[model samples]
Structures are given as C-alpha cells and as structure tokens.
Target: MSEEKAVEENPVTDAEATPVPEAPRPPLARRLLRSRTVRAATAAALAGALLGAGTVAWRTDTLPLAGSSAPCWDSLGSGSMDALFGDRRTEVDEQSLHDDPMGGTGAYGQCRITSYEGDRARRQVTVNVRRLDGLRGTDAQDWPREFLSSGMVSLGDGLPGMASSSRAWIALPQACTGRDDFTGPTVVDIGMGRADFEVSPDEAPRDRTALTGALIDAANGVIDGFGCSGTYREPRDLHPPVLWDSTRTSMFCGIKGLALPAAYRKELRETRASGEGGPAQVCEAGYDSDETAVRLTTVTDPALSEIYSSDALHSGAPVKGTRGYGKIGGNRAVFKALCQTGPVMFVLEQLRPAGKGSRFTFTRDLLPAYVAAEAERIGCGPQKLTLPAP
Candidate 1:
C-alpha cells in the first residue's frame, strides 16, 4: 500500500518507468537468426545477393525473361533487323494502317525505327505503305528521284520492285487492289534515312541480298496485314546493280537512237538508265555541276503514269497523234497514252535550258526520239507524238 500509493502519486517520469515491461518475445526464426553462427549468416547473405543479382540481370535484359519480340507490328523480325542495323538496340514508332474501302482512299501506313548505341542515335529507317499520287502532294516529284534512281536494280523474276543498299520498294499485286484507271498504284517502300541521303548518285554501294530480302519480307507482311489476295514470289533473278556509264552523242542514257545536243555532246558527262521491261524506265545524263541535266523517263505502270496527268493535260502546247494527250513546254514535256498495258507516260526534262533560243527545239526533238525508242522496247511501239505548230 505504501509503495503503490507513492508510485501513483509521483507518476515516475525519469529514464522511463520499469523498462517498458520486457516486450513480447520474437518468433523462432528471429531467435535463430539472432543466435546463428557467422558462417550460416554469411551463407544466407550470399544466397540473397545471388538472387538479387539474377533479378538485376533480368531487369537489364542481360537475361531473357521469355521470348524475343519484333517491332513495327511484327513486320520486321529480329533477324531482319539485325541484318539491317547490326547489333544496335532499336526502337520503333509507327502509325497503324488505315483502309477506307468505301472512300476509295486505299490503304496507308508508316513506321520509323531508330537504332541507338548506348544513349546516341546511330541510324534510322523509315517504311511507308501508300499509293503514289502525282496529282496531289510532292510524291510525284520526290519519289522518282529517291526510288527510281539508277543505283537500284530491278527486283526481277516478274516481281514489280527494285532494291539497293539504301532503298527498296515493291508495288502491290493488281489482283488484290483491282485496276484503278484513275489513281496511282499502292506501294511499300523502305529507305535507310540519312544513309540513303549520303550516297552519291554516280556511285552507290549496294547490299542487294539484305535489302531485297528485307523488302520482300516487309511487303509480304503488309499484304497479309492488308488481307490482300496474292503474294509476290521471292525474286531469284535480280538484275545487277545499276551503274553510271559514259555518254556519247549517238546513244544517250542507253537509248539507241536518242542523242544529246551539240552543246552538251562536247562536255564530259555520265548517264544512268534503269528499269528496263518493268514498271518504269529512267535515263538521266549530266556533266560537272549538274547531276541530271537531261532526264528522260518512261512510265509503263498505269498507276505511276498518273503522276504526269496534270502536266500532260494542262501545261504547255498540245501533243498530237496519240491515243492519249499531253503538252510540251520549253524545258519539260509530258505525254500520256493508252497502251495495251493501260496508260503510259513519256517525259523529257532539261534541268538546264538549252542555249538561249533553242529550248523549244530541244524539247521537240528529244521527246519524240525518247518516246519512239522506249515504246518499241516496252512493246508499246508504232506510237508517234508531235507538238503543235509554233
């Protein structure tokens, strides 16, 4: 009574009262851990450290958690990517393909992939699936220069495509999209971004096997994705890489009968001619500062022919004696006709105009010869074109 009464009245405040009553005892595991030998503790700690190391490896991709995955909607597999971009880590950004059947817009999609070495971007690739449009946008002007350059060789074996180290492209099969007499053809094209840009038009390095294989794989995947009816067979007979050749007055850009003007004939020049017996043929010739002073092109693919529709119909003087119509200007001439294979376009452009007064004469003479020879080669011969008087 005396002790209890004294404690209650004083309400012990110094150094905590009664050492908090010796708190509840921990379970057996805690007791064992507290009493364990140094060796046992070290073994447990080592096991924990190993487990954590494994977790770090998995998180850092040093160890695979499961299977590897492809990017760009699985269109490009890891093997293809590795071939294209060595051993760099790659990241892809894409826009889903859209098809508007009722709208007649066809299908369009795009994917861009950037490869990284550590924190820096090393290379980039861009893939596009869309219809060629000459009427609207810059596709008509820009596409031909990039995709139809002479550096590319035909994707032979009846496949409507071409490939090189820097670029590759394939047209969709006609059976799937039906023949659109009015619009351009749909195509899948891939380019190696700045690598393609850095290449010289005169001489470009080629990786035909890797580039063509990747192109076909990408195209086939697109066809499946678009639910197309047929597939393009692998091109076993791809032609040799297109190379630049020295030009002469008698044969310019490999057109047997075509000749360069007397002024241009004297200058040292080179030419690049490509896409024989296929969708398109391009002949480019120039000297010194001008890589393409004279460009003569023939478009047999009906879809590609539409690229010149506007210029053929509206600009310059009218063309005569053809199943179709077009115009001839001082520096440029565009003509379209209905061949057995559908519509075809013949074009002759002089990037540098002829000597003062002879621009009109230059266009007139060159356009006809280009058309006649190209038409004969492509099985659309016996065709004639004439510009209006004056």
Candidate 2:
C-alpha cells in the first residue's frame, strides 16, 4: 500500500473564501491509496489553512482521533509488536474509517497508520480489517479466495495473509468471533513500505516478510485484547443495548428475493451518496435503486444512545416506522426506522416513476418491517423498539 503521489497537484484555493460548494472529492479508498501525494497535499492544505489564518499549530504526541466517534487502534498499539528498528523508531498514531458500498466488493474498515523513522529506513505501515459483507456469500470456506481477489491477503496457518515486497494484508475470519452481531465476512489489509518508496531486491524481501509477520502479530494481539476480532465492526449491538449505526449500505436495496431479487435487480439504475454534515450529527444517504427510486440512509449521532428517538410514528401503533414522508410518492413508499439504543436509524424509501398509471401504495408496515428485518439481519433483534411518531 505504497501511497506515492506522482501527479502534479493543483494550487490550493481558499475554501473559506469560496461561497459555492467545492467539487466532490474522489472515493476515500481510491484517494487514500494514492500514496504520499495525498498525504503531502493534505499536509500542505492544512499548513496553508493555518498560515492564511495566521494561526499557530501545536503538534501533540499520541493524538487520539479528535472529533471522531470511530474506534481507536489502541488495541494495535506500539506495545502490540516487538521493536522493528530497536530504539530508532518514532511511532505516531492514526485511526480512520472507510466504506465503499459500490466499490464492487463493498468495503468498510478501520485502520491504524504508523511510520517508523530509522537511520536504516523510514517506513510506514497501515493495518486494516474490512468486511465484504452480504456481497460475499456467508460461507467461511470461500473467504480466502474472495479476500485475495480484493488485494487483501490471508495469514496464519488457516488464516488468510497477504504481503507484497512493500505491503502485507490479510482477512480475519468471523468464525472466530462469538458476536452474532458481526454479521459479515471481513478482510484485513496490513501493508508496510519504505517511506521514500525505494526498495532493493535483497532488502525488500527480508524487510517485507518481517513487516508482514509483525502486522499479523499485531492484528492477533488486537483480537486477543478484545477476545474477538469482529468487535470493531460498526453497527454491532449486544442484546439490543445500543446500535452503533449500520456501516454496510450495499446489502440494503428495495429489498431482495430468495438470495436474489430478479424483478428488482433489473430495475437498478444508480447509487449515489449525499450528505455534508459534521461528525457528531453526520448523515449519509444514498439511492439503492433508481428505477423504483429505492433509497437508504444510516444516521449516527453522538447522543444516539441517550437522546435519539426518530420521533417517527406509524398508524398509531408506532411500529411500521416513519416515512421520508412527503419526499416521494405517487408510485412508491418512503419511511424511516429507529433500529436500536445506539439510536441507529434508517430512512428507507421508494419513489414511483412518473407515468400514466403509476400509483404508489405499499404495506403500512413496510418501514417497521425493514426495522425488524434489518435488526434481525444484523443480530440487533427482539427489543421490539420503534420511534415514537411525532
């Protein structure tokens, strides 16, 4: 996972001065993999922003990801691995999350990035575990082959591990986790590379393998700490205590049919993500099907477990769920569902096509059904909770 930036990046523009919205950025997975260029650009951007604003910056050691509710890589911390460069290493921590619902295999994972500066070599490594989810059939046996195709490696004896001369990655099996809420098959990406992007034939092989072993060991240490590897997966709930917000979006469409939906599958048009909000109360919604205008949105808020209650209503029973209400009609349905205590909510909707006789009428229980079904699907179930209709 060498992030080398070869392209000449454009000059920076003052986002604060711009009144109009900036152009949409590329998908995170593609951008993150662009290597050093992205990092340099990001640093430059931050520097420019600070300088232009005449602000002083303070560099802190062991920074916990600020303003983020996402999990930390503390489990895979420095102590997890034996020293690679003796006392010559300086470890910085980074924790990030990414999800690519439409990126073929549907990837979403948390990562920890660290760089070691030594007189011998300056190297950076990132360890990530991304779940392929419903896109891959729920079979443990086929995960190795499926993960490798995604450029992730399989490690351990029966465990899948991958490593190139400069990088190493693997897939952690869900079978090892006792959490039923961890409903999908997951893959891990553990890659390390020389900071300067230089590798020698003899040096590369030995270094890469050593890095690979270290990463695998670190990942295993993480699993050992939690007693389960999949616990890091988002949206997992224990006994419906709290929902962490559903991170997997590709699996939810207008619904499906017997492992596959024939009629609905043919109506697929496009899937686009839309939202511009801060992390505390962020919102990301997308269209799963354009033909029927099927769409979904997962809501996550810091006060979720304590203060979230979709305030949605249903036919006085408050069960079927709330509709995106007036957003769409005439040909289909639109509604919202409050899944659990984490206050994870889903806004599932379907719009009718504008046509001569198109009429939208769905079961009143559709949204509520979605709530119950998805809850069951992700192992969040049996709480029998619903948002109070306001």
- Write the residue-wise lDDT of candidate 1 on 1-390 in tens digits: 112222232121223221111124333123222311211223444456422232110111221123423444345655567667778877666544544332453456666778788999987778887777655434656787788766666776666777777888987755454345456667888888642343554434435555666676667566555443344555655676666678767877777666666766644277877757667787777664245567777888777778677778777899974566789988888888778988888888777654444343557767777777777777777668776886
lDDT of each: 0.62, 0.34
Counting clashing residue pairs in each candidate, in order, gives 0, 21
Candidate 2, overall lDDT? 0.34
What TM-scores do the predictions have?
A: 0.74, 0.31
The C-alpha RMSD of each candidate to the native structure, in angstroms, is 25.3, 19.2
User: Which of the numbered candidates is closest to the native, going by highest TM-score?
Assistant: 1
Candidate 2, which segments miss by more than 4 Å at Cα? Answer: 1-85, 96-113, 116-121, 133-156, 177-184, 194-198, 229-390
